[model samples]
Target: MRFSKSLIILALGVSLAACSDSDNNDVEVKPPVVVTPTSYEFTVTITNLTAAQPFSPVALIAHTEGMLWQIGNSASEALERMAEGGDNSQLLTVDFATHAQSAESPLPPGEQLTLTLTTEQLESLKISLATMLVNTNDAFTGLNAIDVSSLAVNESLSRHSHAYDAGTETNSEAHGTIPGPADSGEGFNESRDDINSVAMHPGVVSQDDGLRSSVLTSQHKFDNPVAQIIITRTQ
Candidate 1:
């Protein structure tokens, strides 16, 4: 009986040791996890809300940092080209840009154009747009360096754009200096003859107003919020 009891104790001790070893072996030590890159798609729509003015080809830019134009500062030479001639090559090449697109055709009055851009990262997401008021000299309507990182997927934001002066040329509205279908005159000159600082447009005082030499008419006049912009995230 004594030998049997000793044998039973030994068996119990071995079983307990095996169970402890199995429990220790079964414990899991997971590895650290890694996150991958996430991509996003952005859609921008611009509408010409003017009565008669036809905007030039629209320029859209997605950048990480830096502004295309400022309200109280002098307009960049690139902005001058876009505001004066409806050209956007230089503006697209602005530093820190991630993606860019331009409308193939001008947006006429009450017309809208939609553009899409994609990015992998959301940090420093910025959007800019510009279009010439084809009926005026050195006049443009758009925004510069609008932060869009806060926008969520499938969500959208809207803004009413205000007109701005390039401050590089005088608003003479003369027969030969104004561009667009209204005049088809000179586009851009290196001269800075007007107020060198950018400001809100004083609006076109067309011949119907007080500027008798103005080639523009009442149809060329516009007020604030000349354009409507909507941005949506698809991805």
Candidate 2:
């Protein structure tokens, strides 16, 4: 009977040892996890350089490398809409543009306006800015598809924006065709009036300069480099 008791005790000891070893072998192991952060932001300040020509609400876009208006290519319908009427809604809704904003109101000559934008990545960020020359037909000014990916935080850059003639309208300087206060005429007519491709603007010749039909005065005449834009990366 004592031998039987000893045998039972031995069996229990073996079972307990097996359970402890199994428990140790069943332990779980896991690796650390990592995540990447996203986002880039910046600001643009625009200063009008013309004597009297007010700029329409400026449209600024941060896109993933795409042209808004090529110098020799035809302007898109969205560009045509904004270029003719100073309306930026359609331009901001373009497919390639990831972020966009428009200035609050007309930027008068000699005045300054600023805007801000953000995007998920900055490696290939391209910027496009545009505004109508309120005193001329189809005349617009601003930079197009400028690469800003290399700009570092708090770094700054500045460039003069030359005027461009949106080939959508004629430079007739006619009374009823002007959209600004000088004439209070129409904006964004569907008809294609001028050359169907983009080109540098030819300065306006106002009524004071013997263009009797032109509603603008000597104050509205302008030359190249109509405005200056400054960009500063904030993030």
Can you give the TM-score per candidate against the true fold? 0.84, 0.85
Clash pairs, model 1 backbone: none
lDDT of 1 by residue, 1-235 (tens): 9999999999999998888778886775657686777888999999999987899888888987888888789888998998888888888787767888888989999999999988887887988888999888999998788888999899999999998999989999999888788888888887889987788898999999999999999999999989999999888
Candidate lDDT scores, in order, read: 0.88, 0.88
Which lDDT tens digits does candidate 2 get at residues 136-207? 878899888888899999998999989898899988889888888888788898899689899998888898
Q: On a 0 to 100 scale, what is the lDDT of residue 199 in model 2?
A: 93
Worst 10 residues of 1 by lDDT: 27-36
